[model samples]
Target: MKAKMEHKEKKIKKVWRNMNIGFKSDLHEI
Candidate 1:
């Protein structure tokens, strides 16, 4: 259970990181 939770947290972190980069790029473009 702990391992599963950790995996999910990592996934969420990665998604958020990608989103952050995308937003930054969009802002820069604008």
Candidate 2:
């Protein structure tokens, strides 16, 4: 059960990182 939670956290982290990058690029485009 603990392992499953860790895997989910990792996936969430990756998604958040991608979002941050996208936001940064969008700002640069302005």
Candidate 3:
């Protein structure tokens, strides 16, 4: 169970990082 939770947390962090990068690029486009 602990391992499963850690995997989920890592996936969430990766998604969040991608979102942050996308947001930065959008801002730069303006």
Give Cα-based local distance difference scores for all models: 1.00, 1.00, 1.00
Which digits, one per residue and each the tens of the lDDT, describe model 2 over residues 1-30?
999999999999999999999999999999
CA error at residue 14 for candidate 3, angstroms = 0.2
| lDDT for each residue of candidate 1 in 1-30, tens digit (9 for 90 to 100) | 999999999999999999999999999999
**Positional deviation of residue 6's Cα in model 3 after best superposition, in angstroms:** 0.2
Clashing pairs in 3: none
Candidate 3 C-alpha lDDT tens digits along 1-30:
999999999999999999999999999999
- In model 3, the Cα lDDT at residue 4 comes to 100
Q: What is the TM-score of each candidate against the true structure?
A: 0.97, 0.96, 0.97
Q: By descending TM-score, how would the candidates be arranged? A: 3, 1, 2
